[model samples]
Target: MKMIGLVAIVASLINVSIPFQSRAETVLSARDLFDACTRADMDWISFCNGFIQASNDHAVRLGMACTPAGTTRTHLVEIFEYSAARLLVSQSELGDAAGLEVASAIIGAAFPCN
Candidate 1:
């Protein structure tokens, strides 16, 4: 009887935790955000592997020069240029102007093109 009670308790705990995992979602495409921004702000290479995967997927999607090198600083500069151009055009669309400026500064730190 004790064993059965313990088993039931464990089962209930598992059931309760299952939904929590499913309800959580990735907030942003780490690579897209990094490419559009910077590594320093993102803890430097924390998202490298994931960013590479996303970039490869994007490369396949857009047929652009996005190689497996997307996670590297060199590749990131190219991505930054593209992202900056897009962001410049869509400045009015950004809801948080200050946040965008900060992000731009962080990205610039990695590649001081400006």
Candidate 2:
């Protein structure tokens, strides 16, 4: 499916769509993000990019709560991608909250403020 907007969908899925909405992005449900990210309708490149963007946004936001010092944004995105991959493997059937939790955990574990 059209996965270009998966980020906004994900944000809404976790009840945090203010940033996207403020940017004029449409808020979609978790089902939509899941479909767009998992379905084959979208090309691999687009899907990969979407995931990268999604992971980037998630990591940056989570980093705000912690001191991710000495960690570059690029590195954070990469770790987030790995976390996303792990989520896809095991949490695919779970709800959107599950995904968000895992993402936060990944960032927190990798770059804890304490």
Candidate 3:
């Protein structure tokens, strides 16, 4: 039957795709984050913002960073972009670093508590 053939095709397709999905990297790298942040696409920009905000939140909770009361999300993004660029350029190995680690370092350095 055509329906049975179609079902078999669909099942085979799903099986083929599973390995690729599993191989996808779950952790975002600093280079990838920097690329996303620098993109002109709104979707990428939004992704960058969300990722930075989440990283900032975690860093704050862990006492790794101390954001000033007047600091805005845009400010945080700027800080990350600038710092990440310099860091990635100076330390090429850091491009492979976890996004969270890079973001936390940037945030902490930008807003260190005395």
Candidate 4:
């Protein structure tokens, strides 16, 4: 019946890998991400959040951190910029690896599981 068809569609969508190009997949520098963040670039913020969400999702699965209820995403951008600035002192590219670094640092400071 209709329920069976709907269940099949949901099951099929579960493992589908949508096109999500993380910073590592691109060549933009960390400086740029930070710069965009300073200016509050909507596009950059959107992309940055998307990137962080993926990292956070994985970290949650590993029980690394627990996001406080009612926490706003604004913190994600703050953490991203903070981490990027710290890292950019040496390296340049703020690739997806930086996203992971950001997530780890933020988890400890902002959402410690303890």
Candidate 5:
């Protein structure tokens, strides 16, 4: 069950494109998500928010996180932005980590299940 949830999240994040003669798989990176969350573009900001919400939902459903009731989207975004920034700064390698992986980690850390 946990594996299924993880697979679903991963599938949602994978971007598969088949151009005329080429195939490409583009996955969102932690750095990209961080930039999106901090950017001025509304579209990027919306995308970032959606991604964080989905990640948090998945974590909670999987018993990985226990977010407090009444947590708003804005709060989730703040948590992600702050945590992701610290992680990216301390571990350069995390910049390239899958966005879902980073988001899941942040959510879990901020709201761990007892």
Candidate 6:
């Protein structure tokens, strides 16, 4: 019985430590930022870099989503936005430009205006 209890406790701890997948993946590093923008196009490199350096401030002003654990919401939002953009970009040949445009629009749209 003691061993079973110990196993259960350990499992619970692991579950708690693992951030929920539903919460979205946070963008933290330059690569992550770049990847998000690049999904739209190679032309977005400069755009992505500029935004990455300015992202924190943007997140603050725009009220981006953040984890209760203190993970910046911008990171997760960026990831989600990037994913949507990439999907559209990848399908541009398939008449996905509108979808990509909408997804890409959301990236900066979430930022709060000061």
Best by lDDT: 5
Candidates 2 and 4, the one with greater lDDT: 4
TM-score, each model? 0.31, 0.40, 0.76, 0.52, 0.76, 0.26
Q: Please, what are the lDDT tens digits per residue for candidate 3 over residues 65-105? A: 78888888888999888777776766665666567666766
Q: Candidates' lDDT values, in order?
A: 0.38, 0.47, 0.71, 0.51, 0.72, 0.39
| Ten contiguous residues minimizing lDDT sum, candidate 3 | 1-10
| Global lDDT of model 2 | 0.47
Residues 14-52 of candidate 5: C-alpha lDDT, one tens digit per residue: 333222123114777778889999998899889888999
TM-score of 5: 0.76
Candidate 5 accuracy as lDDT: 0.72
Candidate 1 residue lDDT tens string, 51-99: 4445444434544332443356556545444544444344423212222
**Reference-based lDDT, residue 41, model 1:** 50
Q: Which parts of model 5 have CA positions greater than 4 angstroms off?
A: 1-24
Q: Candidate 6, residue 73: CA error in Å?
A: 13
| TM-score, prediction 4 | 0.52
Error of 4 at 54 (Å): 2.5
Those runs of model 2 whose alpha carbons end farther than 4 Å from true positions after fitting are 1-25, 28-65, 94-102
Candidates in order: C-alpha RMSD to true structure: 19.3, 9.4, 17.1, 13.8, 7.7, 15.5
> lDDT at 58 for candidate 1?
47
lDDT of 6 by residue, 2-36 (tens): 32332333233334443434433442322344355
lDDT tens digits, residues 1-114, model 2? Answer: 122233333334456423433533344333344444554554743764455456545656756236345755446546656555554455453233543444444555555445
